[model samples]
Target: MTSMSFADAARICLTAKYATFSGRARRAEYWWFSVVYMIAAVVVAGICLAAGSVLPGILLLLFIVPMLSVSVRRLHDTGRSGWRMLIALIPVAGPILYLVGMTVDSVPATNEYGPSPKAVGQPVG
Candidate 1:
């Protein structure tokens, strides 16, 4: 496949791999998805409030798996195990640590998890 731009990567994460949790995700993919997810949440919450209904909550539920999956993949890209995602459970410090981990650049070479997402012509498995 061709290299994806930030928007394309985010769209793929939200649509094609909505619930997939077993691959690496590049930094651009993760950050773009996060920005879009947050914006969407705000918009949905506003719509729900205006309509006085819980309908928009469904949208949030739909994105939950994709969010987690991308996060796991992003951690993998940084050469960390997906299980490290549990660090997000540590109240404030937990999320901060997780954020820092995700912000780190991907390992230049493959790790136990898979190949680098940013590497061209490399098979992911």
Candidate 2:
């Protein structure tokens, strides 16, 4: 999982169905994708800030959702509901809660979200 590619990470995110909050995350699979997403966002935001034109600026500003899609997927991979993202709106408590939740490892076996992602990584039984 390179820090720049979105392909594999996107697949992992899509396959993660439930949000029960359990299991281990493959560090590279999740973190690197996050780094790539953040860096791209910063660059895009900078471009929008530098551009003076309103329409073009707004156009450049529209990448937020697609960019964060992977993060949402990562959350799903960790068995977290995508709606949990709304926590960002709660001021300090919001982000703190999100951080706490996102930091928790995945449930050990099956969770509300679906089967264990770890099972997919191991040799077949």
lDDT of each: 0.82, 0.54
Off by more than 4 A, model 2: 1-7, 10-28, 54-63, 66-72, 77-79, 120-125
lDDT, candidate 2, at 10: 40
Cα lDDT, model 2, residue 47: 75
Report the lDDT tens digits of candidate 1 across residue range 1-125. 34556677667777888888887888878888888789879999999999999877788887788889999989888888899999999998999998899999989888877777667775322
* Cα TM-score per model: 0.87, 0.57
State which candidate has the highest TM-score. 1
* Per-residue C-alpha lDDT of model 2 across residues 1-125, encoded as one tens digit per residue: 12323556544433442231333344345655566556656676677668843444455344344335544644665777777778878988998887676666756577665564556555211
C-alpha lDDT of candidate 1 relative to the true structure: 0.82
Total clashes in model 2, counting residue pairs 3 or more apart in sequence or in different chains:
7
